[model samples]
Each structure stands twice: as structure tokens, then as C-alpha cells.
Target: MFGLIGHSTSFEEARAKARSLGFDEFADGDLDMWCSAPPQLVEHVEVTSRTGKVIKGAYIDSVFVPEMLRRFKTAKRKVLKAMELVQRSGIDITALGGFTSIIFEDLNLLREERISAVQLDWQRFTTGNTHTAWVICQQVERNAPKLGIDLARAKVAVVGASGDIGSAVCRWLQRTGVGELLLVARRPQPLVALQESLGEGRILPLEEALPEADVVVWVASLPQSLTIDTDSLKRPCLMIDGGYPKNLDTKAAAAGIHVLKGGIVEFWQDIGWQMMELAEMAVPERQMFACFAEAMLLDFEDIHTNFSWGRNNINLAAMDLIGEASLRHGFKSLGLEPASSSSPALSIA
Candidate 1:
């Protein structure tokens, strides 16, 4: 069975989920874990290249961020408990979704924690960032033209460039021929290493990187809101806000900047089961963050290895593999919500 570890995006959502899970009352920090009913794929979803692979799995609610993430100890405990739950439920591979993936940047810490709790092999875990990068790249390619920006000549800046998803995104943009690339992160060392390997791009601190970018990819691993003054970016910028807790202030988008919720793909086919019933979670339009989709697609491919682990190690081959697997599984972003040039900023508050 496959397992997805995630947290509610808001307190209200958390309470609703808890009640549905049979909890009379669930406070902000309470965690809940439950198994999904066998996901019955409809004809449209089942006729994909995978023929008909039905995935049986479980999902964990890591709860909202403020309590779980306020301190490392609390976050670590919650993650360990979730891992234990997945292991006990006999899930072969568990995808660490949303904020849970970011709590421990050093996978070794997570590894030790896993061993302490379940003694399972590290290969049983993955962050699923490869599919996330695939979705982000696809969004950029699909939306750039409409935004009147030529990616071939656009100045693209990737915040949190040293992280897994951000680095993969940089690689994808380079392959697509972005004219200028700027890598932004807290430190310069990792950025330097990435630039040396890619043979291009300039590395700058976060503050210095914003004003010059035509298309800003804010995909940082920050636990809290980023401290950038949104007003600094060049106007008419296309900002792909890919952070889990979301790093960009919506006010920036309110001032006429184009912002697209990144790392998510919406399924347009007539899937017989609603996402809420399938996963027992609240998500709009059967759309899921690419990170979570990675697990489902990998299950279809029977690729049980640690497909995406650690930071900054995702190569183009892995990205391509997940992308293809997604398509074969009948996953398409075609009619899903495209990042609108006139849409309001996302509310992370």
C-alpha cells in the first residue's frame, strides 16, 4: 500500500477532517491517520497506459503548521508517529508530503528517526519532488506565452535554488533555454556548486535576486513567510509560488503581478471518485500537488526505490521518468486551472 503524509492547510480544514475521521473534536495540533478505501479508477482514468492499476493506500494528517512546525522537536515527533502509522499499516512506500518533507532537510536525521520507530529501509521513503519539478516546468512552458514572456529570452530567477524542487526547476528552465538564470538562497556555496555543474547562471542572496527577475520562482524551503518586500520585483513578473506554507505574500500578486500556484496538477478527466472521497482530504477539482501524485504514479510504475530523497539530487532523467509515468496514468493538466494573469494572490494566512 502507498501512504501520503500531509497536514491540513488551515485549522478549519483540520477540524473538519478530524470530525470525518471520527474524532469528536480535533484541536489545531492534533494528528490523525487513516487508510483510504481502494481507489476505484473510473473508465476514463483506468484506460490509461497502465491498463488498470488500482492503488490501495493510507493518508496521514500531519495537522497545521503553527503547532507542528513551531519547534523542531514537535515536528520531528509528529513525523515519526506518521511514519510509524504507515509502517504499521504495511505501506511499502510512504511519500512525505507538504511541510513534512521540509522539517528535516538532512535525510540522515529522518533516516535515524525511521529506524528508531520502524526499522525500515531508507528506500521506502521519498519526497516526491521530481514530479513536482515536472509540473512546475510544464506550467512555465504552458503559461509563459500567454503572459507575453518568451522563456527563451526571459530572465528567470529561482529562490531556494539549493533545495530539491528549486534546483530541479533550474535544470528544467536551463534545458528550455531561459535567457538569464539567477539562483537565490540563504547561502552562496550550494548556489556556486549548482552553477559550476550547470555552467551558467549567477548566484545572489535573496534580497539581491528579486528586482531583476522576469519570471520569479519562489520555491524556498522556508518554514515561515519569506521576508522579501513584494514591491521590489519588476512589475508584470510571473511568480510561481511553489512553497508549501507559501513564501510569497499575496499582496505582491494583488499589485498586478501574475502568480501561479506551482507544484500542483489538476486532473481534467472524469474520474468517478471525488478527491475528497478518494483521499478523505479537502482539495479542489480533484487537483493534487505534484509531490503527492508522485507516489501514486510510482506505484503505477512499480518503482519502489527511493525515487526522490535528499535535497538538490534530482536529475533530469528522474524528472522525465515521473512526467512520463504521470501521463501514462492519464494525468493531464490540460483543462485544469491555468495560472491566470489576472487572478488574485493565494491566501497563506
Candidate 2:
């Protein structure tokens, strides 16, 4: 069976969800109490593909909240414990969603094994980034024209261009004939390397690139202190917020500036799961994060392996493979109307 490892966006949301799930203890627990809680397997999912293939899966709540981010040791342990649970459950393949994936990649957790006598098997886990990049690219290609922006002539800027998803997005856009590619990130050396590898994109500061971009793909975390100047943004500009805590709408709201949720996909039919409800998706039954869907796609295809892992390892071929699988199994980029209409208050898997 496949699996998905996830967490709540905040402690309050986690408490509410815990109560809904009948975890009364968790419902009353404080952040510190939550940090010490064990991961929970909250859902057993059955999804049927358009091709009539059926797959079984489970959702493992890491019991992690964004508030734990400052507590590095707690954050690391939460992710590792969830991974350990997945491994012990005998799940064939699992996707690390949201910050779970980020922690795994950032901490280089692959070197870890034998979590309290359970040997961790790296092959059973996938970062699910390949499909996410593909979905984001598809969103850009499909949505830009609706706003009357021709991608071939539009300058696209990728925030967090040096990240795993961001770099993959940059690689894909390079082949799309965009007018120009602008790379933005916090660090310079990686940005320089990415620019050198692409041999095309202009590396620029986020402040400078925002005004010039016709389309902006954000895969980075927005600093809490940062405030976007909507007045400075181009009218009719498209912003694809692919980052966690997806709050760009609140920050960049303005006339003629369209913000679309990036890295999301819609299934043709209900997957008979309620996990998305916890994620607070507008259409919980059908809408889901592309990263989570990747695990489902892999399970449906019976490709029980880590299809996506490691940093900067995502290539055009991998994206194309997963993209094709995604469509064949009846998953596509969610439409602009639903994407724009729904504003999930918290970031989640």
C-alpha cells in the first residue's frame, strides 16, 4: 500500500482536527504536549483510477506544527518518527508532504536508519516533487493564456529558484520558450550555479524581479516581515503561489493581479478520502496537493519505489514521465476558478 506523511499548519488547527478525529487528549494538549506525541495513522484511503485501477493507502499525521519550526530538535524528531511509522506499517511507497519533505531533504535524513529498532528503508519514500513541478508548470502553461499572457513572450520569474521544486520548475520553463527567466533566491552561490547550469536565466534579487515579471512562480517561504507592494506589480500579472503557508492572496491582493495556488491537482472522480479536509482544501473530496497525488499515481501504476528524491535531481524526463502518468490517471492542474476561490487558512500536506 502507498502512504502519505503530513502535518497540520498550526497548533490550533491540529488541536481542532485532533478533537474531530476523537483524539481528545490531543485536543486539549499544548504545543509542547504535541511535540512529544506519537504519529497517528488517521485514514485508510481507497482510490480508483480512471483506468479502473484501485489502490489502498494510509495517511500518517506527523503531529508536527509550524510552531515547532523554531525547535529544531523537535521538528527533526517529528519527521523521523512519522517516517518510522510508515516504514513499520509496511507501506510500499509513501510521499513526504509539505514541511515533512522539506525536513527530510534539508536534514539529509536518508543517512538515518534503525529508528528505535525499526530500520528505515529509503526506497519506500518519495519527496513527490517531480509531479509537483509538472503540475506547477502545467498551471503556468494553462493559466497564463487565460489572463491574455503569452508565455513565449512573457518574462517568468521563479522565487526560490535554487530550491528542489524551484530548480525543477526553472528547468521545465527553459524548454517552454518563455521570453526570459528570472531567478530569485536568498543565497548567491546556488543562484549563480543555477544560472550557470541554465545558461540563460537572469539572476536577480526578489525585490527587483517582482516588478519585471509577467508571471511569478513562488516556491519559497515568504518572510513574515515582508510585505508585497501590490501597486508595484504589473497589472494582469499572474502569480503562482507554490510555497507553503500559501498566503500570497492576502499579501498581494489587487486589481488585475491574479494569484493561483500552485502544485495542486484535481482528480476526475472522488478518491474516497477525507485527508484533504484536514488540509482544508475547498473541494476536499477531489482536490489535493500534487505531491500527495504522486504517491497515489505511483501506487496506481504499481511503481513501488522512490520516484522522486534528492535535491536538484529532478529532470525534464522525470517530470514528463510523471506528468504523463498524472494525466493518464485522470489528474490535472485544478482550474483557475476553484484555485482562486479557495483560500486554505493553513499550510498542510
Best by lDDT: 2
Kindly report the root-mean-square deviation of model 2 from the true structure over all alpha carbons: 2.9
Q: State in Å the error of residue 143, model 1.
A: 0.7
C-alpha local distance difference test of each model: 0.67, 0.89
Task: Estimate, for each residue in 1-349, the C-alpha lDDT of model 2 and write its tens digit.
Answer: 9999999988899999999999999999888899899999999998888898888999999999999988988888999999999988999999999999998888878877778888888889999999999999998998889888999999999999999999999999999889999999999999999999999999999889999999999999988889988889887899999999888878887888888888888888866777898898877878889999999999988889999989999999989999999999989786465543443422211
lDDT score, candidate 1: 0.67
lDDT of 2: 0.89
Q: After superposition, how far is residue 53 of candidate 1 from its true place, in Å?
A: 3.1
lDDT of 1 by residue, 29-95 (tens): 3333222111111111221234576766566665535444555666666666666666766667778
10 residues in a row with least lDDT, candidate 1: 35-44
RMSD of each: 5.5, 2.9
lDDT score of residue 6 within candidate 2: 94
TM-score of each: 0.81, 0.96
> Clash number for every model?
0, 0
Candidate 2 has its poorest 10 consecutive residues by lDDT at: 340-349
